[model samples]
Target: MHRIFEFDDIIYAVLQHVKSSGTDLVNVAMTCSRLADSALNILWAEQSSLAPLIMCLPQDTWEVTENELGHIVHFSRDPTPIEWERLRKNASRVRRLVGPHGFTDVLKLPRGESFIPDLDVSGYVLQRLFAWSRPATLFPNLCELHFDAVFSLLECSSKYWLLRKFISLGLQALRFDVIDIPTHEAEQLLATLPAEAHGLRQLTVSADDGTMALTVPPSLGKLPKLIGLAIFGIDVCLTRQTIANIQQAWCLQSLKLKLCGTSCDAGGIPLELPSLKTLHLSDGSLPQCTHFLRQVTTPKLSHIDIRYRGSASPAEMTAFIESLSTSCQTGGYLERVHVIDESKIPDPLLIIPLSSEIFRPLFKFNRLSSVKFVGVGNFNLDDGFLYDVPDAWPSIRELKLTSWKRRAIDSVTFTAMMSLASRCRSLQTLHLTVDATQSTIIPRAPDGTEKLWPTQTALRNLHLGYSQVSEVARIPYFLAEVFPTLFDFKWYDYYCGHYDDPDIAMISALSALNDALQELWALRKSAGDHDLDERWEKDSDDSWT
Candidate 1:
């Protein structure tokens, strides 16, 4: 251990690859005060409730007793000057909190921010403590405050005053986690946000689903540093004026919201977002999505993740796609597009088979690398679409088009899928549903000689989701012919519920495909192939987990 200080460069090099956790980390932390302090500081930072910290005051300062429901904490008496100073010093170190739990109820504060979460801290005790300091001791330098209460703050309530007190200019993030505020009150709180915290960067207001209609206050857009915003609500949340104001936000980059039901007003000024890059919308109808796409022009946009919660006609889908194409400037900058249909229940209106024509608008974004569409499947993908994809997205890496429930929509075939292998040379992960009912077909030349089919050597994973596959015995060879370097071949069964129970047929199919790969890997391994192990260490996977 003394050698750690002797050679600092050697220690740095050794520490880079060392994996330490649990008792190993605890034992190491116990060796020094600095490491122990850091570990305690991290644990105390995310403490969730103030109950634990409040107890650290002088022994007689707070009394712990029991009630009908649970234990409670109340001030025994006023803290003396020295005791108060001791409490203040320790409490000030808390930078962020994610709770209020049962603390507010015991404090007799239905709306008071003073109410501690998950603990029965007395109301009178908090009132006296906060009253002692104008800015409030608990809130002086809090960068983040997350409330778990279903609180509604009326103007005269302590919750409102405490909320205002907590909203200092230094605060960076705030979240309303537990309660879904009514439209008027939500607007009131949002309206007050910018005035208090001009440096606020991220804001999240969550509800169960789209049941609550939350609107963005125009004042929210005035925050100079506000970059990320996610609100779970219906279409009414994004008013025309709100959308217009959002376009003018040069600092804002990512926005996530759900759209559904009716909004009396739907149009927004055609405003441009110069720095906007990632936009995610879910529970949105096709018309509303098309409307949303028409409202904003984001030249720097790279990723668009959207979900159709219910139904849409082919024309509506096409119109939405067209609007999306127009909204994003397609000088080959767009990188990812994920379109999903979350309607688990089947609907006659939702039985719209997806055609390549609906996606043709995206051809302009030639640099698109990752494209995914799930459960919007009733695939009618044509040869032209597959043939043109390599030309359209030459550098494509991941393409997933899958539908598990509706096996009735499979039209794409193996021959058509093979066309992509020649051009999309860098393709790695593919999730496509193809008509594999005729699984015995072999690739042959025009003159009838046995021809070698084009194989994608870079392809690692092939996910055939509920696609028809007969003659299972011969399918492995067929897969090996298409993807020579494939590491995982999944046919008919998709990987969704991999842990709940084992499927016998899925296991059999996986084993057969793996056997086919063993022959393919035997030659590569003899030549020193360690691709699989090395590929797992991606640049983004920096943490141990």
Candidate 2:
């Protein structure tokens, strides 16, 4: 035997690597006594389903049947003391029961946007098992669980209360899905979890997209130990109280709250969250964004994502931008910001009056590295405003300016873009719509014979969204001159909401432009001149010369 394998840590890590593959792990375990001892614990530590664990009991005690609902298991009678002893030994090694496999691995769930597990037998089975598991849970050492079975806790029903037994003090992470659980019971169970699962650091309770909207449980503001909270398909009941509680949860750092309507109050005392770093809000109306942001402040806020379902009016847009400056502190430490409008606001693209005035407030955030706006109205921004962007955000890494409608006229000139690469030397990605119908190339050398591109930076990816480009033959050279380091370039397609495709001819032209960009980069790499932006042009000698 190798002397290095004698160390316990080395043996454990080697076994851990092959744990994901059952066949390899089994082979390693059979090879020696030391390997087998460590493999047993890893095998029982995480389970994708309880089917295998339930089979640990005596065969005569339980039965499995296949009906329309795929698979169901039932116990003929309670397990004897000997049977319980054997199960308890195996359960001690169980640390995680909520494996990657969903209920689809156990049952034939309905087809929908999501699968909400309907555990008619799981609840009953857990009750009988715990009746014998006194002074501790069945899986006493369990540290994580995804309790998918939703059960209604009726007034007279004592059976449903056993579901709470899974929330042990040692558990640190949990993903609880509520489908048919009564609103009052769900709220009570969530609020009381701190008593049983005081060590819990993460919790997520959500329903399917079209399922019943779960209410925000009371006393969320009191969870001092909870590190993250996310709730989806929520009705936002007690909106004022919920926000107030969240404001006081100083330990909370991340939040994802999707509201059903414009339920925020017009006026309230500003809520202060001293520890919050990331916020994702999905509002029903764009105005609600202003309403919500008007009252809360995240001092340590670094990343914010806002998604609204309706069209953004100029008034609402202006108010929303103003709230950003107030919501974050004077440090201007925000790093990533994304505002997306999921509205299918149709046609007349240029009718809405939008310009640099609405988004000017964001430029004050000196630490911003990434910014994205999609489905918002098109910007009639002139090159003068965009030219100031490089100086405003010297550390900027990514910028995606998108819209849902095709541009009638591109106001942003292509002439001013090279300055971004020159000034913001760290800039890497750029997504913008510009008028590339004319070239901005100037004399490169002391004599008037050669043309030079802009300053080279770390810029690698460029996506021209909804830009007007008539001079297709001139664009590749124009882009290569400015962004000599660029490797991936796309046209018209971007992520926000969606955009009406340009005419067929325009789509073909843009696609051809992308193909040409890739080919150019490949050619540059083949010639081993990827770093030198000084050498480039359309020379017919099949060489960079």
Candidate 3:
């Protein structure tokens, strides 16, 4: 006789493989008592809407009528109370809850209007469901809760009560989408966070409507376990006292501010955030950023990303960069710096001066790895800046110099590239526009002996802008000598699109050189005593280029 798997085990295995819905799981549960226990757990793990579960109540407790639009469930006239014990058994298994739909627009239906008639009925059923489940804590196992279209529900006292009951469950993360809610009401909703929410690790509050402005409750700083906080499309002014509260908390590690306001008074208190590691500022005005940077000090910040609309004045830009540099030097080394300019300029060649003083403090920190200067125009660094680049940031893995003028590429450009290949061995991605013609002449020794290009074993991606066919022809040998690990090469030309197509002659030459290098490597591996020079001299006449 063959052994048989248990019924519950079979059901669990089937559930894992299939995208079984709640109704399908209910049917399986009715088939066997053992399956019922396991099926119910999987049925309520993730709930997009509570209608299906609510409809499971007895007909006398709640009646659902099917109409032309969809099924609408409402409280029955008969005084048949909800079976709280039975509902709690399944509700307790829910680990995540997505807020119901159509709470804001009455005409909008729930889940495509298939079952819910209007917002009024949806809100009525949801409120009663919460009221019944409140006795036993509806979602005892809930860890993540997302609230969408919460503005309309917050207007009703009973619905607000239901909202509070759910938030007091000590959830790990909470997200609120407050669109079109009055500022005061939004504040009230935020103030309802229970003291048990100290375990909350992530909190996000965003408003979709531009006219809506929600304030950040000072009580938020009291969440001891909170590590990530994101507030967008809301006006949150960080005053001296508020900064003090944030500093005292000392648990936050990541903060994202978008479309927010910051005010730094003349004698404002210094905002010291010692534990913050990542800060992102977007859509913030230049003056606002300057004030915030001047007041705030982050000792452990590792990443700073900024995106703004208009251009910053020279004085404002200088102050902001200096403040950021000072903070990085004191706190920890910066790993990445990204500045995106959103202003539109008519000229293609706009030079943004990145003076030595702006980058001097950065040289002291070795952890600086990825640097991107993106704008409509190019960025101009001082002369000989590239000479110290390898020494200043030896750990750099990504370097991008965009929209540079033709003058940016001169005789010194080749020397700079050689230096980067020799010194910054960790570089993996390099993006720059080079005049390949300037690199045709190979470097030679004082005695007129040709020197070999330094090998950059880590380089894998290279993007070179417009180059002549002749200029590109001379690069395959140099690339084979310098970048042994390079696999992705991109070059643009006025006539030949990209040099990546197989139909292109340049690509064929590159491939041949790559094969030759591979063959040479294989030969060295097979025979340790093989003279590489003799093999190369013999094949020099038949070289790929």
Query: For model 2, which pairs clash?
Result: 221-245
State each model's CA lDDT, in order: 0.65, 0.68, 0.60
Q: Write the per-residue lDDT of candidate 2 for residues 58-159, one digit (tens) a residue.
A: 878876665565455568777888887878776787787674453223322333765334333444565666677842456788877766532222222542
Off by over 4 Å in 1: 1-30, 34-40, 55-87, 99-136, 149-159, 177-185, 207-212, 234-238, 263-269, 348-350, 437-457, 470-474, 481-485, 492-545
Expressed as tens digits, the lDDT of each residue in 301-354 for candidate 3 is 888887765655455667777777765656235788766665545244444454
Q: On a 0 to 1 TM-score scale, where does candidate 3 land against the true structure?
A: 0.67
- Sort by lDDT, best first: 2, 1, 3
Cα RMSD to native, each candidate? Answer: 7.9, 7.4, 10.1
Question: Given candidate 3, what's the lDDT at residue 308?
Answer: 67
Decoy 2 TM-score against native: 0.79
Can you tell me which runs of candidate 3 are displaced by over 4 Å? 1-90, 98-128, 149-162, 194-196, 212-215, 233-242, 261-269, 313-316, 342-357, 404-415, 440-449, 465-473, 491-545
Clashing pairs in 3: 299-331
TM-score against truth, every candidate: 0.74, 0.79, 0.67
List candidate 2 stretches off by more than 4 Å. 1-3, 55-84, 99-136, 149-160, 207-218, 233-237, 344-353, 442-457, 481-485, 493-515, 518-522, 525-545
Q: Best candidate per lDDT, number?
A: 2
- Candidate with the greatest TM-score versus the true structure: 2
